[model samples]
Target chain A: MKTRAVILYGLLFLSVFLVLPWIGPESIDPGKIIQFLSGNNTPDGSIFWLQRLPRVILGLLAGGALAVVGAAFQVLFRNPLVEPFTLGVSGGAALGAFIAISIPKLLLTWGPFSTLQVLAVLGASLSLTLIYRLAHRQGGVSIYTLLLAGVTISIMCGGGILLLTYLSSPNALVVFQRWMMGGIDVVGFHELSALFPILLPGIGILFLHANDLNHIALGEEMALGHGVDVKIVQRDVFIGGGLATAAVVSLVGPIGFVGLIVPHAVRRLSGYDQRLVLIGSFFLGGASLAVCDALARTVLAPTELPVGIITALIGGPLFIYLLISRIGK
Target chain B: MNKPIIELRDIYYCYPDSEWELSLSGLAIMPGEVVGIIGPNGSGKSTLLRIAAGVLSPIKGDVYLAGSDLKQMDRRTIARYMGYLPQELISVYDYTVEDIVRMGRYPYIKGFGAFKEPDQRAVIRSLERTDLTEFKHRRLSSLSGGEKKRVFLASVLAQEPDILLLDEPTSALDIHRQVYFFRLLRELASDGLGIGVVTHDLNMASLFSDRLILLLEGKCFRSGTPGEVLDSSVLKKVYGDGLLLNKHPESHRPAVLPRIGPEKSS
Candidate 1:
């Protein structure tokens, strides 16, 4: 089962990376892709090179980041239901986007980031800092406290978002709603390059601690006894996962279920080893999101649905099926 | 005397916002010996065991591991020569028996790599020693209580440490399995590993341990040979004459029996 799932996910990941960018609303000529690679300035070449490819790459990176972080956090927190969004990253980002939309005077751009993205990241960082401070104790941060603090902050952010929506004009409300329904619509490599700095190290830290996370799943004291510096692992995973979630949520506006469901689906396919779990979640997650993005782009042709909606439409039923089947087993 | 594999001297410990405090003047476990820590509920048996294992640090005094200050050593370095089994093993993920045991090699793993040949052999040997070879592929959630405990024992065994510290390892096992477990510890001790166990069963402690330390209210009341420590006079003071000490029928080791009150006809 493990071998088959690995192959299946590997194939899916590679095929999605190659295939999804070719299937957008306006199909690019196969010859144009080669022409784009050779630096031609044709209209078709620009569409394929500058537009579709970047969106596809963003799907891969953002999806991979969320799932990998989700897997790491689940082990670190010792809870199966935890995901990237559980730590208030999504709530904070949404609130930030809402603020940007409600007040157009704040709609300024900096280098690669729009005002909304910048504020979203700032909002996520704020929530992360608050949760960290709340959970910190004399010796180390308490996992129980961290979970509770995150949930409380998420609720507070939700409330803030609600108030902003109530006060905003209908024009701002439409834009906020669109952002809330997450989409990955990058036109070039600028946003992708901007994400790399925060995203790389964040994901890298989680991947590096895969073994420590495995020992942690046994229990905290057990992990400590087995030579894992549980305190360091906890701190790194929390901050690392938080930063990565913030970056991805800022860019894509908090796509749903890819973080929550992909790792679980990977665990079902593979076993509980975090080494396998993290890697499998990355590939399978990347593939799942890229496929969803393709559906979002073409399902209504000119009228695109949010990729987040497509993910929920597909992922919700898939998650339910997994749950029922697990019970049946 | 042989140098103690692990020793704790003048240790003081307490949890924050709690009145309970433990102050142990001195304790040591020498190689090829089993030291049973027998104490009533909340008498600091588990805490002492954890201190010896280097999992818990005392606020005052020194812990020596193989003649070195334990506080100065990193966890991986400490774990290389010592194995600890926590009392309650709550596995968050449903890992297989082999998966759990393989984790015992965590201290030895050099980098971000797969378990090597030696680690695999150690895991297999541990599973075989604990009689868990057939159950290696089974998930922990599917196992019986006794089976689960043995699985963790196997994990600790896979570490191949010179000293082992266990907290209430047999509290959940049946009588027959408890005896089997103790005998296994005895065999491990005979092979030159020092073993420290915290247990509630006095009779089993008497039979298995070379030395017994009886604790009362955060202090060591007695520490000596099991026959010397399990005296009726010594027990009466702590247990209030509610317990009787007698001889094991075959081994002649001191065994404890509870004294019954006056019978009522109903």
Candidate 2:
């Protein structure tokens, strides 16, 4: 069953990978796409390669990162309701983006990062550091303390975002509101190249601990008995999942529900093994977000809805159906 | 005549900011013997087992595994030789019985791809020994309390440890299954595993155990052969007068029975 689920999710991801690049407000012929791949310049080819492909790739990376982090956090915290943003990463990133929008003077680019993206990364780092310090103890970070600290910091960041919203000009408020809704509107691969360094290591650290996470979900005592170094696993899962989440949120402006629902959807379809769950979540989450992004682009034809809105709109109802169907089964 | 496989000497433990403390002068589990830790509520049986398993470090003194200091060894090293079954098992995911049991090989696994043939054989043997082969694919949530306990038992068995520390291992099992489980422990002990069990079933402990450590109020009340430890005078000091003693029909080991009547006015 789990193997079949893996294959099914892989097919979904591959189909999205192949199909979504051809799906946009402007229809591009397959021959033209192949022409673009072979180095011919045409209007359709340019749109397919430069506009649609980057967005789809960004969606896959960001969605996979968020979902994997969410799965890791749920196991680490031993709470099914946990998401990637539960630990204040999104709150901090949103606040940072809000700062960039409200204060025009701060909107300067540095290296590969725009000032908005840089500030969002900084904001996420600040919260991650603060939460770690608050939760750290003599032996290690206490999971309960870490959870409480993350929540407190998240709420504080939310208040800061509200204050920034209240103080902003109407135009800035509108931009900030749109940023808060989240999107993947990259024109090229420059941003993705910068993201690979952070996202790869963060997600790699999580993947290495998949078996440990499996033992951990049973309970700390059981994990300990199974020869898992509970303290080290706790610390690594926190920092790794935090970094992955911060990287994705900093770029995408806090896309919701992909992280929250994909792991659960995977666990329901696949078995509860972390190895399979993590892999299934990555593929299924990437596919789900890619499909959503495609819909966001072509749903109204030319005036794109934020992919974040589409994800929440589509993901929430889809997850409910999955749950209801399982119950009915 | 064999040196003790696990020894706890002059150990002391207490939870932080709590008045209750557990202090022990000495305890040991010899090779090829089943040592039962029988105690009243709050008598620290679980704590002792945790200390022996190296899950809980002693506040003071030493725990020795095959004469090496326990504090210096990491959990993985200890787990290679010692298997511990916690009293409570709760899972957030609907893991299959086989999945849970397979984790017992974690200590032996290195740079994972898949379990080797030896690990697979151990899992199969554990499931078969526990009569759970048919239920290998069943979700843990679908099992009864006794069945869940057996699944954990199978997991611990899959570890293939030299020493086993179990807390209330048969608490949820039926009468027949409990006896069968104790018989299995005896077989394991006779095959040279050092077994320590904390159980409330004094009669079963008396019948099955080679030695018994009776505890009262976080202290060892008695430690000896079942006939020596389960004497009415030795037990009355801890249990008061709400008990009766009988002899096992076959083994002639001392057995405990609860006195059934109206409660006496204090």
Output the number of the lDDT-best candidate. 1
The prediction achieving the highest DockQ against the true structure is: 1
Query: Whole-model lDDT, candidate 2?
Result: 0.86
Which regions in candidate 2 have their CA more than 4 angstroms from the true location? Answer: A1-5, A29-41, A136-142, A326-329, B261-266
Error of 2 at B145 (Å): 2.4
lDDT of 2 by residue, A14-115 (tens): 888888898877777878878987888878888888888888988888898889998999989888778998898888877887888789999987666788
Enumerate residue pairs that collide in model 1: none
- The segments of candidate 1 whose C-alpha lies over 4 angstroms from its true place after superposition are A1-8, B262-266
lDDT of 1 by residue, B157-256 (tens): 8888999999989987899989999999999999999999999999989999999999988899999999999998888766676787889999999989
In order, candidate lDDTs are 0.88, 0.86
lDDT of 2 at A6: 77
What's the lDDT for residue A147 in model 2?
82
Model 1 captures what fraction of native contacts? 0.72
